[model samples]
Target: MRGKKLADLNVMERIAQEDDMGTMTKDESAQFKADRQAAQAKYGQMSAEEKAAVRKAAQQKRLSDLNTMERVGQENDMRRYMSY
Candidate 1:
């Protein structure tokens, strides 16, 4: 009987399996720190109700955009079948 062997995966799988620590380059490290500080300041100013409303609005916009594009794609596909 032959033994089964597992296949070696790519770097992406390894990265996903491990924790992130000191993985960024110098430039990325600086930018990430700046972004984090900026986000903390902005989020600190928003009330809980305002934050909830903003998240809801973002979700609604994404859903609406997805629906609109899906409709446009279906229309285009239907036209292809109906043409003489």
Candidate 2:
């Protein structure tokens, strides 16, 4: 379990693994803790529609970022080929 890759676990399992590991990095762990606490505090005040909108926006941003990364990767590959 100690040496297991995160890719091998499902979401819940990966969360469990992270919890078991306890310290990902001091700064990261503290930031995550703060973020979770903030989200939890804010979530209770949000309406259902607001939560849905936030989720949708987050998903769209994630997809947009992924597409941008793919395009950049393709451009880098082309540049490498041209240079060679």
Candidate 3:
């Protein structure tokens, strides 16, 4: 049996494999990141559904942190308004 070629992998899988390879030098990694950033910057936009999904995830994360913030703020308020 023959082994599969690296080029045969899909985009996401190829990126993952590159990540696994661990051979990319710091300069190469920087260039790859810059290229990706430039590509995203040029006429980069998300669909309504994608935007909604991101917003929903962010809202969910914020909701998870709400209780922690409320506790901290309540504690601060109690200390600020404390009577001697």
Rate residue 70 of model 3 by lDDT.
80
Cα lDDT tens digits, model 2, 3-84, are: 6677777788877766744448888989999999998989889999898777777655654666666767766554443332
The regions of model 3 sitting more than 4 angstroms off are: 1-44, 68-84
Off by over 4 Å in 2: 1-31, 68-84
lDDT of 2: 0.72
What lDDT would candidate 1 get against the real structure?
0.68
Clash counts per candidate, in order, are 0, 0, 0
Distance from true location, Cα of 44 in model 1, Å: 1.9
lDDT leader: 2
Q: Report, for every candidate in turn, its global Cα lDDT versus the true structure.
A: 0.68, 0.72, 0.67
Per-candidate TM-scores read 0.41, 0.43, 0.31
Model 1 Cα lDDT, one tens digit per residue, 1-84: 024222454566655556566577999989999999999899789999888777777655654666666867666555543442
For model 1, the stretches where C-alpha displacement exceeds 4 angstroms are 1-24, 65-84
Q: What local lDDT score does residue 44 receive in model 2, on the 0 to 100 scale?
A: 82
Superposed on all Cα atoms, the candidates' RMSDs to the truth, in angstroms, are 12.4, 13.6, 15.9
